[model samples]
Target: MDLSRRTLLTGTAVAAAGPALARDDAPPAVLVSTWDFGAPANAAGHAVRLAGGSALDMVEAGARVAEADETNASVGLGGFPDREGHVTLDAVIMNGRGDMGAVCALEDIVHAVSVARRVMEATPHVILVGEGARAFALEQGFDTTPLLTPESEAAWRRWLETSNYAPRANSENTDWPGGASDHDTIGILGIDAQGRMAGACTTSGMAFKMRGRVGDSPIPGAGLSVDDEVGAATGTGVGEDILRVSGAHAVVEAMRAGLDPGAACRRVIERLARLRGDKIADHQVALLALDRQGRAGGFALRPGFTYAVTDAAGQTRLVRAESLFS
Candidate 1:
């Protein structure tokens, strides 16, 4: 791999022989997810794969781990609420066949990804929002529960003191002064042994954001895109900019145009850099991709971005993504 186009963390390799390894040597099944928390998520997803689950099952199983984690303030039940203390969630699920479903600005739903799947499987609509989404979830047998925990409520109260709503670059990956890290979304992609691809993305949106704010996570092609013949991609970070460029779809298209997964992700980040220029320094964005051959790569606008990968053999590793401004 060219150093200019792809950079790997010191002492970390995307695969034992790196991403450029021959296709025949690629793992029979592969799972990749955004952020350090994704390591365990991948493990959870891998268990599904080991049980003969499809790519769709792997992605969904993986996402549920983070969504149920109360310590993870960026996703699911314990996520930080909006300015009004409303904990709205967003999620999307996409299959390689181009079918997708999403939910945005949903309240009191812990597993928004499952609701997204229900939307895809049960409804003619591609999306459901707010009250409609909650109703649909209830009709689908999903229970409504209070998502706000004491820890998150305390964090929201602390933010109420200053009421400063400035977006911080990599805030999801770092510790705040008086509170736990206000994390971001979890995006998981998988290619099963049969080579089918699928992806899922779920988030609580930006911490202390305006009520009803929806980010890229719930939008297909922005947060996630999967093409069985081409590849799959998903993103995290400042979703506004990611959505503006259809970040995940762009990476998959680049892979179709012949770029490796890493280079494809880098291409999109470079475009974001040019579009935002110096302003890009104020926020963070990152993308992770998996080709049909089970190869994977990731890139970010700033450092400290990490992703987790698990192969067919059940080996898992956390990789610090290469960044443009590192």
Candidate 2:
């Protein structure tokens, strides 16, 4: 559906440095995510928020929804395997107070977002990677298991038919080519009972990626970022393009500088196009943002980019994001 700015921003959120549209004492609230496929995650996160959980709690819980999904080759266990047939994961979490944690090049663990939270609440470090991330997951009580699923295996074999290591922008992992970006991440932002914000970003990196390749999913300020005083942002599409300018952080900074949620997102998209020059034509990069006051906006490099929103009234919808190329 075409969501007007009013419809996109419809919801009550926590008290933030910016003026909120709703009352300060608003009880429960809405959540926003990077992809149209994020409704399930938004539902899960909203359920947790309804039960009085922290926004951080809901954000992690919500991301777990995507982690467990096998049909979506872009994320979690069912994701497309690396060129070596390994399914490595990357994830990050940013809490209300600006504390952050991440896991990169993680293997076998289905719930990478939870492991990221452990790094935030359990360790003094900001990131854990490779075998170290697996160790942290093991110590945190996650059982080791093979992440490669039957569906992922079948897809990998299909890719091997060509045996072409040369990658296309959106040709890998998905059923067909030319829709979404290759490096898509499930990114979510939520505000709970308390007037605070938190967010999560998780992915299986790029499909058929090189062994040990880690995308922006586990990188703060690239895949996701939250500032209670200003707002929050998440990204999908080309991780490399997102990382160059720390896309999410840039959006938050724009919001802080007086751009509303939508305007900030559009400005970031413009910047991405300018910085990347002609490279972005073959790929896509999207940014989604929500201000402390509950205003939201999204923009993308290509024609097809959509974000999900679940409002206080429990209505969830997929809205086509504004796109420069469209």
Candidate 3:
């Protein structure tokens, strides 16, 4: 049944009148989203769904899966490092309850952001950074690894051999009128059986980032934003502009304004395009939204992005531009 934005937004009884109510093996109705498919983020989502976990649990579990995979350059484990060769990680988690937790400029500990959640639940702070974040991870019994791996070392070594030291436009060095450029990061959002919303974002930060640069991944309303009463948004590309645009929050609010997920994502991208006219090449992003009713949609500046949803019949599939745009 194709439901209009008006019906989806205003009708409080959609579950009783939609396909979601008829499926016997609904599989918790989880949807996983990321900028790139065949990446760690996708794998993480698959793992969580198979484990019968909540969307927030899936996001954290999936992020950890990404952090452990060495092949993904944008996320943890073997991801890019600073000029100093430290592979610091940044992560954040937000629950439907509006309580949020994050770790920024973290090092040595994989899944550092998950540790931040432990802190969020055990302590009173909403954010943690640097040495403090690392110490907390250690206390939580997270095994310490030399944040840098041989593969990342080799990649950096090869990079140094080239003259690409000039930072990209989206690097934190940019001096824009409103906000600095943001960096690439892995972001995830999921909706579970209980209609609860949760989101998490993780990244090794920008390549050649400053020794301690931290971007929007761990900042609420920037890298990731979730409102159970509305929808959830996760941002990719320049976190700085994402922060100024409040890209994720913008999409969620747009949804509230009656825009479908695709329109909401398009609106956010259009604004960013105007902000970084000439430097638009590197100022890219992907945004995904899922309303409380289990309808899913997303938009991205670049082609080939991925987002997933479990439809009314309970079949879950990894969605990409090839299947969506074409």
Q: Give lDDT tens digits, candidate 1, residues 167-246.
A: 87877545531123534899999988788899999998999998888889899999999999998999999889899889
Q: What is the C-alpha local distance difference test score of candidate 2?
A: 0.79
Q: Give each model's whole-structure lDDT.
A: 0.85, 0.79, 0.67
Q: What is candidate 2's lDDT per residue for 58-95, written digit by digit as tens?
A: 89999999989877787887888899999999999997
Residues 183-239 of candidate 3 have per-residue lDDT tens digits of: 256677777656788888888887767788887788888888898988787877656
Pick the winner on TM-score between candidates 1 and 2: 1
Weakest lDDT window of 10 consecutive positions for candidate 2: 11-20
For candidate 1, the per-residue lDDT at 274 reads 92
In terms of TM-score, which candidate is strongest?
Answer: 1
Candidate 3 C-alpha RMSD relative to the actual structure: 8.1
Model 1 residue pairs with clashes: none
Q: Please identify model 3 stretches exceeding 4 Å from their true place.
A: 1-29, 38-52, 166-184, 310-314, 321-326
RMSD of each: 3.3, 5.7, 8.1
If both were scored by lDDT, which would come out higher, candidate 2 or candidate 3? 2
